[model samples]
Target: MPKQLIIRGVPDAIARDGWWLASDATLPQHEPPSPTFPILGEAMKRRMPWIASVVFLVALGDLLFWGYVPGVSLVIFAWAIFAVACASRPPKRRVIAPALLLVLASLPMVEHAQLLSFGFLTAGLLVSVAWLRIAPSRGVEVLGAAALRLSASLPVAGVKGVLNCARAVSHERANGALPAWFSAGYLMRNWAFPIGGSLVLTVLLVNANPVFERAIVQAFQIDIDLFSLMRRVLLWVGLGLLVWPFLIVQAPKAAMVVTPPKTGIKLGLNAGSVLRALVMFNLFLAVQSAMDVSILFGGASLPDGMSHASYAHRGAYPLLITAMLAGAFALAARPFLAEHRALKPLVLLWLAQNVLLTGSAAMRLELYIDVYGLTYLRIYALIWMGLVALGLIMVAWQVLRECSARWLLIRSAIWGAGALYVCAFINFAGLIAADILTRATDPTVETQTDWHYLCSLGPAASKSIAQGTWPKLQIATPFWATNCLNPQPVAMNWREWDFRTGRINGYLAVDAKMRAVRDEDPVGR
Candidate 1:
């Protein structure tokens, strides 16, 4: 029979032979078995597929495509999800969850507006997950592990259950043990086929699309192609993800065992990457707002839904700053993922993409100050957003590629996600405030409440004017850019407005002061 005795605060262990058989203190602490009570990180990693499925499924459901866009999106989203899961090399049995999710997501939705949105949401989620799984090289793995150690030592993940397993794999490698990729054929087996196939497919598919145009342009010296430009930006972003490789000199196999590290990846925790990424990400979001960038890279142009605010200047710039600053002040405290950290790797790429886009825009603006000079939410805005998205993906890719090195992906994902969600929450609040101010026709919501509110409403107000229905005035006078006195700024309405150097085409009226500011900086326009 098992023996148990309570001694004041603690329980007594087994005793025999007429005496207390005191166990050596050195013997491992009496703790839960490793199998039954598995480490938290591993458990979360196991559930990533399910979480991915849910996100994808919900997005697919939101697409709202019926007669308007042709509901082929459901099939496409399912295929994408399945393809991503397969690419992830999910544990043999894990495939079921994604498969079931794909089927469930196709459940018919009655709303017309929801179809396209759901489709987009689903596709984005699947693509993100697919991007998340790619593994970095072994050398990078070492650096990644070190970063993990340092990240953990900082007060980031413990509270939220984010740090431990959020960006799980390479984080362990950060300390010491090499992942499967370190083995001779591991690289070829793990990535070669996928990388090669993806490269060919992306090139072929993009080329096949009528709207998918690529051009070589003069930038500094060497002629730069679109692909090359994107690659350059992403390469630097990848480099930035290698934080703290030097800090953790060695790592033990036992995870959740925190150790101290002196240094970390110095590049502002991928906040720079976020700035770069936001250049494109904000643009990507903008396209959905406008009817450009196509709903699918698969085709040309997708329809825009109800959400009207384009995060052009205020959104992208603020987001970029936040992403960059988050590295030190905010980045340290959150889990490696919990979200914002998810974009850590693409810091350089994002910057480059933005630079390339801005450069391209400047070139166009130089020719026609009145038409092209002003910031417009057209193809260029989409391009900017694409740059940001691409940069972010590249950063995510860097994390995945180097997953063997830093193990930051799984752990950081949680914190990165959390940060992003928090940002989303902040956005929602601002959106509500803007809605209130739009109807209030007063300064209460704009000034007394969130100053950021005006940024979220500009595009919506522009659309209302474009449709010839002046939205119910929030203010009779120009309290902010979104007021009745002035038309939406190019920063807000530039995308959809037909533009040229001399003429302004959309709903908003153009002026000398605004046009001068818009037209002045030809180089940066």
Candidate 2:
């Protein structure tokens, strides 16, 4: 009374595992599946064409940038290539936001190739790539994590990409079928003799006929500049390295990881120590604040034998550093503020004073600039002071809300980046030039304009200088400025052309025409 089952076309293992088969019946045998290492998946195979195109397009960096200053070409190279690469493998979420930011950041590069513009562009690229790799619901912390991952992978991305591409080609060849005529073995056997014979016959003909020799010489002549060739090769490699990371977006495994709180002995950064530090800092800052209000802001005279300019110049930078240290202290003391309620007030007071101090430092810089003249450094100092003030405000907000340090840092970075982005688009050089020229012409102003510094601001300030009529003011234009005013016609292709340079060139042309007309007519002059 045993169970009997009949199976047809089944493996022996299945029949042995409980199924019964008839003795006369036959079954087919199948081999076990082997392990596989897919060098190129179906998706990757589809993207191969785009990947190849990006590689070829980036390789042309030598042609686009060589012997020319970067301008719109940088914008084109950075944005267009990145766009195409991103399109090849579209992100799952948050595409429009990053795309808009990338475009906005690159727009500055189209105007000019200043360090600020380049910096913003680089930051924009990193952030956009990071955004593309993370989830839609992710926060700035996740974005930062993804960005760090991308940056960490950059050093090896190019090599990894090349290996991947090579493996894909091999994979395709191993799996695909080729026509007999196009197969590697077939081509080698059939074409080698013909190609070799043609080369030998061409050489013989060149030796036998003068006309053939001249034609051969003309056709085969290659002026191989080894240096140029090496440079282009290096450029291609560098661009490949820079571009591959963006092309292959590697999403982070996790947005953030929460670690358990450490159960160790508490450090000295407790309530007592924080309270004492805050009290001491507040007292010290209070003293400085009083001095600033009395002497710096009230327009009162300084100590005997000390000039206002000297006082302002000496105090501006040091006070800024002091504010920065104060900000650091505020951030450190944040943890203790909750336990010791009294420390919060003290910290807030300290931060408020630090903001005041930043303002005073900015006022001091203004005073010094009024006596002397405005320069790039002073403008930068002003911008730094503003950022420090904003940071202090953010620290105060963090304390009030009892937010995490990560929250504070993320917000601070966002505000700072915004400030920098706006600063990138500002024409500071033009402002500095106009300020100096205006002060120089004022009969009551005693400031002496540094024409040398003006020249160093480059073509951006040239229009202001020209309009200031330095010749009539009895101040001769710097030789560099003269050259800028009458720049020789140098051949520049479209890649090197930028809005700033074009505007300057146009202004110079019109100014030249006006000058010529004025010289010809006495009334116009």
TM-score: which candidate is best? 2
Q: What is the C-alpha RMSD of each candidate to the true structure, in Å?
A: 29.3, 8.6
Cα TM-score of candidate 1: 0.22
Worst 10 residues of 1 by lDDT: 240-249
lDDT of 1: 0.39
What lDDT does model 2 reach? 0.77
Question: Taking the tens digit of each residue's C-alpha lDDT, what string does model 2 give over 258-288?
Answer: 3325557455788899899888888898888
352: Cα error in model 2, Å: 1.2
Best by lDDT: 2
Residue-level lDDT of model 1, residues 1-525, one tens digit each, is 989975774333343332334454333446765443223345455656544544454444334232133333445544654554455452332344435544443332111113333543353334333322323222223333433444454343222233334445445445434345544577878889899999898778767864553441222256658986676555433322221111111332333433325476554544454445455665653443333223212344323642212313324344334333422332232234335554543334333444444433333333232221222333334344334434444444544554332444354454544443333212232233334444444333332333343344433334333332233433343346444323444532211222221132232454435445646774664
List the global CA lDDT of all models. Answer: 0.39, 0.77
